[model samples]
Target: MRVVHVASEVFPFSRSGGLGDVLGALPAQQARLGAQVTVVSPWYADITQAVREVWRGPLEVPGSVPLTDVRVGAFTEGGVQFLFVGLDAFDRPGLYFPDDVWRFTQFGRAVLPALEQVGVVPDVLHGHDWQAGLVVARARLAGLRAVFSVHNLQYQGRWNLMDGVGWTGLPDGVFTAEGLEFHGDVNLMKAGLVFASQVTTVSPTYAQEITTPEYGEGLDGLLIRLTHEGRLSGILNGLDQERWDPRTDADITPFGQLAGKAACGAALRAEFGLDDAPILATVSRLAEQKGMDLLIAALPELTRAWNVVVLGGGDPRLEAGLREWDAHPRVAFAQGMNEPLAHRIYAGADAFAMPSRFEPCGLSQMIAMRYGTLPVVRETGGLVDTVPHEVGFRFAGATPEALADACAAARLTFDDHAEWAARAQEAMSLDFSWDGPTREYLGLYARVLSGPLRPLVGLERA
Candidate 1:
């Protein structure tokens, strides 16, 4: 199988969330399974760290930015090929920007030809999120098979119709409501949902949730149609087990030994200047959606019993809310993306808390589990799918009270030495490996490319 993934992010190079992790792992695994895999992502500013060689550019891209002046580059590794589209529109710190329509629209137009230029005709063109929605549409125009994955439905990438129809070079009537148009604005997500040969999301429950207005972000009705037509699928994401493993990860050091957790907790407490107590750590984006507000609100109540470590920075106001608790003896806040610290936090903490108001497919919960730190998440999205009842705690509401109840349950569990250790062992034993999801993806690919369509069977539950 010749497969190409078009996305704005990938790991070890670029990432914002689980989208990058999923895109990176899925393709690499596909390559290992004997598929010829190529991943094309934007060469953002920090791409200087990547080992790449300048490739021939000036590749003509119709209806968008000319690749002629844009210098193309590429790097290959481990049986998979990586390509980067270097242009001012993509050369930025963040994966997204205000003018993303122009940026990725041109990128979508360039991807198919880029593959052809490299002497490969893909059997499947895979697109991730709204960033690659246009790529899926372009694949259909070229009469090729394409799969569009919706990592998050909330971010639809809506823009004006004038810019959409004018620059997209799409056929007439495509901008209508039945197509990519939604309430007079161009919805990039809809473009993929409507045109792709198959549509997939992260987990089965989330796929079901999205077809309802409650979780749909206004695109539920359309998704329901697609699901009924047997063109929609949900494959739960898997983690890079090698990177997150406790036995091999250097960062997991002292924590992996017998009685190491006690020393680990003490060291982390000293580093954060917090009181010695049962530690709850959150290495999550400081945002309302991650249930940061509930965590903050419940902190006064939670800190009274547990020492808490908060990491990751985002949304000034949310960070401020967490910072206000910094003076508390049991509360510590370390802002920003500290990868080493994150690994340590997972290893050191007694419980990893993620009271997300919504989650597509959370890698942190799985990452925390890999380190033998139990997860406490609100019962929603991927959280509903992954948090095994025997291993982690789950709460229903996005309220402080509900979250506090869950944390209390976790702390109680922690008090039981044998029980807690047993649960942690069970959590650690989970197979969140790329094996299952990759097989499902290949099955989906084969099904989409071949004869009569049917629902994918034997999907592994996270």
Candidate 2:
């Protein structure tokens, strides 16, 4: 089957978060599964400098503004073709900018033409997040099956109705209540939800959670209808096992050798000047959604018994809050993204803490578990699906006390070396690889292709 994945980011080339990681790993895995895959992403400044361009030409983009300079380029990697759409707007430093609504709309408009230019037609056009949302409708117009994946419900691409219509060159009628409209604004996420042949989220629990009022982010009614129509489902995200494997990772001691983990742990403790207490590490963005605030609040009680190491930076207020703990004897806070340190933390820490208020599907916990580090997470989203009690610690309620209780339970297990080792071994043994999720995606695509084509909503007259 021929498949095309449209997203704003892809790992190792350009990425801001999990969306990049997903696109990076999933398409490659799909190619390995005997499917021809193509990934379409913006050619940002950082990526332009790294890759040798294979193809480049002017792109046909719809809108009032004459986009004569818009171009598309291509490169091949890991058996998958990558097409990068370029515009002066995309030449900016970051993957996402303030004018993203206009930028991605243009990117989405270029996808089909770019594919045509490259002489590839896909059986399914898979779009990720709000950035690629507009592509789904365009794919349907081209008589192709389209699948839309919602990585997070909170970040719907919303803008003025007139602006969205103008940018997309879509009819004003498509901006109504049953279409892209959300509170009188044009929501690109809603466009995907309304137009796609199938809609999926990261995890099973999250799929269910998003259909409810609590986690729906004000789109529960629509999600509920989609669920009933049998057009919506969830497939859990998987780790790139080769990249995260403890047995062969070059960054840390290979697990095959005896005392490798222990030696690494000792070195980590020394690096942080931490005493020989159970080390709890977190490699995450410092944001309230990640439950960093709760971690901060629980620090006083937690530091009394365990040493904590934090690696990540976001939300200046949260950064300030965590920095205060830097002076504490048992706390080590390193702000900003450090890939090498993250790998070391995963290998050396006794347990990983991801007390997210709501996590769709977290890669960090999976990565931690791959290194035989038990995850202590709150019971929500994919955290509930991946981290069973046998493998790690879990707690309910998004409170400091709840996180502390889970950590306390983990501390108890840590004190019992044999028990901790057994649990860690179980976690390490569990499969979180991309093979299964890739198969599920292929199945979804087949189902979409076999099913009767539903009438396009919003874009057509009833």
Candidate 3:
């Protein structure tokens, strides 16, 4: 099968978050599984210099921008073709610019032509998140099958109706209640949710959560209808085991050797000037959605038993809040993204804390578990699916007290060396690899291919 993945980011070339990571690993895995895969993403200013030009032409953009210069650059890695689309609007410093609505609108418009220029007639166009949402509608109009995956529901690409409607060049009728319209705005996400052959989220629990009023982000009614129509699904995201493996990682002591994790832990404690206490580490963005505020509130109680190390930066207020703990004897806060430190923290920490208020599917917990570090997470989204009682600790409520309780439980297990070792071993042994999820995607694609194209209901071609 031929498959094309359209997204704003792809790892090793351009990445901002989990969507990039997923696009990086999933397509490669699919390629390994015998599907001819191609990933299309914007060629941002900071993209690696390694991507060479392969195709270039004038792209016929509809609506406002009638035509623009389009360049397609590519390289093959892990049997999958990586295609980068270049346009002046995307020649910015960041993967996501301030004018993202217009930038990705152009990106969405460029996808099909980019594919055509590269000679790829895909069986399925899998678009990720709101940034790539409009591609689904465009693909469908061309009679191609498309699957839209919602990585996070909260970030629907919304803009003023007049501006966004013109950029899409879709029929005026499509900007209505049954189409891309949402609360008097043009919601790009709604286009995918309403018109795609299938709609999927990152995890099973999240898929169910998004169809409810609590987590739906005001699209519950539409999601409910899609679920009933048998077009919505949840396939749990998987880890790229090779890149995250503890066995071959040169950053820390390899898993089975002498001193092993203990040596790494000792070194980490010394690096941070932390005292000899059980270490609890968190490698995450400091945001409320990640439950950072709750973690901060629980610090006074938590620091009594476990030394804490935080790596990552976001939300200046949250950053300031966490910095106050830097003076505490048992807490170490390292702001910003440090890849090497993250690997070390995963290997050395006794337990990893991911107290997310609502995580769709987190890669950090899985990475921590892979390094024989236990995960203490709130029971929501994929956290509920991956971290079972036997492998890690979990809490129900999204509160400081609940996170503390979970950590307290993990601390208890940490004190019992034998039991802790057993649990850590079990976690490392569990398979979070992409092999299973890749096969599941292939199956979904086959199903989509056999089914007829979903009608646009009230939508019309321009």
> Could you estimate the TM-score for every candidate?
0.94, 0.97, 0.98
For model 1, which pairs clash?
58-68
- In TM-score terms, which candidate is top? 3
lDDT of 2: 0.88
Q: For residues 218-326, what per-residue lDDT tens digits would candidate 2 score against the true structure?
A: 9999999999999899999999898888888888777853346887798789889999898999999889999999999999889878999999998999999889889
Q: Which stretches of candidate 1 lie over 4 Å from their true place?
A: 50-54, 64-67, 254-258, 452-462
Better of 1 and 2 by lDDT: 2
Off by over 4 Å in 3: 257-259, 460-462
Question: Candidate 2 clashing pairs?
Answer: none
lDDT of 1 at 240: 94
Q: What is the per-residue lDDT of model 3 for residues 10-116, given as tens digits with 9 covering 90 to 100?
A: 88888777888899899999988899999998888898658989988888767788546888898789898888889889876877656898888888888897888
In order, candidate lDDTs are 0.82, 0.88, 0.89
CA deviation > 4 Å runs, candidate 2: 48-58, 257-259, 457-459
Each prediction's RMSD to truth? 4.5, 1.5, 1.3
Per-residue lDDT value at 258 in model 1: 31
